[model samples]
Target: MANTPSAKKAARKIERRTEVNRSRRSRVRTFLRKLEDALAAGDATQAQAAFQAAQPELMRAVTKGVIHKNTASRKVSRLAARVRKLSA
Candidate 1:
């Protein structure tokens, strides 16, 4: 369908961008999942470590437009709360 040169170029760019974004999103989710698993396992130390690792990745996702800022904030807040409860 991309008959024009510009359109063809755009298609290629879109494909590349899609792959990059997909990988970023997947990596973010993997971090989140690790945090969740740590929490579920009731290991405060592991959960804290996972949370520490996930926080920056989630923020990066927000900065990269993969996730909303508030969503990331909410996730971090909730995870932090859970970790705090474990520490208490």
Candidate 2:
């Protein structure tokens, strides 16, 4: 449906960006899942480590516009709270 040359080019660019964003989102999910698994397994040390790894990835996703900033912050806060509870 992109009749204009510029529109066609923009469509192509969107497709590429969509793929990249999808990949980034999936990677972020993987990190979150790792943290969840570690938490579920009741290993405080491992959970903490996973949380450490996931934090940056989540923030990066926010920076990249893959997810909302507040959503990322809420997730990080909740996970951190759970990690702290594990230690207590």
| The best candidate in terms of lDDT | 2
Clashes of 1: 0
Local distance difference test, each candidate = 0.94, 0.97
TM-score of 2: 0.96
Question: How many residue pairs clash in all the candidates, one count each?
Answer: 0, 0
**Model 1, stretches more than 4 Å misplaced?**
none
lDDT of model 2 at position 46: 97
lDDT of each residue in 1-88, candidate 2, tens digit only: 9999999999999999999999999999999999999999999999999999999999999999999999999999999999999978
- Model 1, residue 5: displacement in angstroms? 1.1
Candidate 2 all-Cα RMSD: 0.7
Least accurate 10 contiguous residues by lDDT in model 2: 79-88
